[model samples]
Target: MSDRRAIPPHSPPSPCVNICVMHKTRDLCVGCFRSLDEIASWGSMAPAAQREIIDQLPARRQSLKRR
Candidate 1:
């Protein structure tokens, strides 16, 4: 059997792609574009709060790509 389990419908999905490297200049994760504090507190954040962070990811990714 697979070790993976389904996430509950109400929970916000994590953005982690397992690449945990931190960008030296940007202070964000190069893989998921989340800051260190965001990553650290993600589990405890409310669904709405999580969604707020997720909403910002696309813009962050775009900014990184422009560099």
Candidate 2:
């Protein structure tokens, strides 16, 4: 007998805008504002964690503007 359980859907889509460039001073992607580690591990993160990251994006963008 095969054990079947419904797997939760993936977290919300990545914020990648396809610009794909890491800011030199900030070490964050200019398009998505995610750090290298965040980008790499996004696929495995839980929905809540991903949402947290998403929520922080606007602030990150604003900070970048100040740089």
Task: Highest lDDT: give the candidate number.
Answer: 2
Per-residue lDDT tens digits for candidate 2, residues 1-67, read: 9999999866898999999999999999999999999999998899989999999999999999998
Please provide, for model 1 over 1-67, each residue's C-alpha lDDT reduced to its tens digit, 9 standing for 90 to 100. 8899886547588999999998888999989999999999999898888999999999999988888
Q: Per-candidate RMSD vs. true structure?
A: 7.8, 3.3
Each model's lDDT comes to 0.91, 0.95
User: Each prediction's TM-score against the native?
Assistant: 0.82, 0.84
How many clashes show up in model 2? 0
Q: Which candidate number has the best TM-score?
A: 2
Q: Model 1: runs farther than 4 Å from truth?
A: 1-9
